[model samples]
Target: MNKAKKMLFSYSFLAPSIILTAVLGLYPIAWAMRYMFYDYKGYGQEKFIGFDNFRQIAEDGLFWDSVKTTFIYAGGKVLVSLPLALLLAVVLNRGLRGRNVLRAIYFMPTIISSAVMAVVFFTIFNSYNGILNQFLMKYHLISKSIDWLGPDHALFTVIIVAVWGAVGNYMLLFLAGLQNIPDDIYESASLDGAGKVQQFWYITIPMLGPVLQIIIMLAIINALKGYESIMVMTGGGPVGKTEVMYLYVYKLFFPTAADAGGAVQQIGYGSAVGFVTALIVGAVTMVYFFFSRRMSRTF
Candidate 1:
């Protein structure tokens, strides 16, 4: 085909996807950026207020509080989930009977809707009538029922739930990475009188570095973007003790009477928060890539 005709054919093939992405994705991003410079209520009046919204976000105590909460939530999810997922992946990577069934069982949580999982966990973590407390009481582990969703335990509960929901996906990723490792490498390590631990440390882990890098990137991204499960489970409740950045931003756009005196229906402020979050995540990803490159050169 002629150059122009070939170019036109390529563009035709891509047009549908490009159009859909522009409409569904890029349009909202543009809208958010525009709204970020204005005092936009859900309807009616919108005043173009430049950097005032961003300035307010900078000065807002609740915004800072949400930032702290976001870090805690993200950190907790990564710290707890990644190790467990790696361990599970290693265990399943062994040529064990029923490994496929076990893998499916673990991954079931990932396939289920977050809202449904939240509801299931809500019942499990219920204060008095829940199965967890009941089992504890039955075993005489505690004389009284523990409130899993109380102010003191709410954040921990959320973290535990998040980890449980996330581990399966990471496990599958790790398993795929593990499978790609050449058996000859491990066999050579064994010939060198290396134990299982030494083989893992010297051969498996080094071989899996690329996969680990990808896993870390994914974990950080998901941790930062964590919202739906928290929204469904706690609703950033128990006096905002469990409030993370995404939830905080969500409340900004869809304000409740309890959020910021119900006077802060600022779409601009929310968009600014979104922008900041995107930047933070991008920076983190870039750092990961930088480190990965260095590690690749060194190892």
Candidate 2:
């Protein structure tokens, strides 16, 4: 083909993706940015009131509380999931029988839709009639069924579900990192009198540093953004106990019928909140990057 036709052909291939991204990704963000300075419901005439939406964010205690709850949820999920994922990666990386099947079983949860996974967990953790309750009751483990999804326990319950779904993904990443390490390094460590745990601590961990940094960063962002299971399982409450920032923003734009009339859609305010929430997540990622850079220097 001639140069012009070849160039045209390349541009043609890129055009569809560019158009889709502009429509699906860029347009919504631009729309939200425009509306953030306005006072509008989804159906109302928009009234521009610059910075008012942001000012309101400062005084919104509920949003702040949800931010705090989000930190807790994110922290708990990361703390539990990363170590377990690494451990699973280490174990499964070994030369063991049926390791492929085991890895597949562990990974199955990652393939499930978050909403569908949450629904399954809902059935299992249902306080009154759940299979968990039935099993515990039959064994006389407790005098009565514990409320797994109540206000006090709801956050914890969702974290467990989040970890269960997330660990598999991190494990697979860890497995890939592990496989890239040379077997010769382990053999040398073994000859030098290093035990399995010693090798893991002194060799595997140090070697996995770069990938670990990336994994932890990804895990933190995912945990902070995770709200699907919380929304599905609790709808952000028996008492708003499990309300993360994203879920809170979701309700602002799309309140459930159960919300008080005051909780109706405020598209402008929702946009502002969404912007702030994105900033919060972005700030966190930046902080992690900062620390990771310092740690990388030390190594």
List the RMSD of every prediction in angstroms.
1.5, 1.4
Query: Which residue window of length 10 is worst by lDDT in model 2?
Result: 255-264
lDDT of 1: 0.88
Error of 2 at 207 (Å): 1.0
For model 1, the superposed segments whose C-alpha errors exceed 4 Å read: none
Across residues 198-224, which tens digit of lDDT does each residue of candidate 2 receive?
998889998999999999999999999
* TM values, all candidates: 0.96, 0.96
| Candidate 1 TM-score versus the reference | 0.96
Name model 2 segments beyond 4 Å from true.
1-7, 260-263
* Collision pairs in model 1: none
Root-mean-square deviation of Cα positions for candidate 2 versus the true structure, in angstroms: 1.4
The alpha-carbon deviation from the true structure for residue 121 of candidate 1, after best TM-score superposition, in angstroms, is 0.2
What are the lDDT figures for the candidates, one per model?
0.88, 0.93
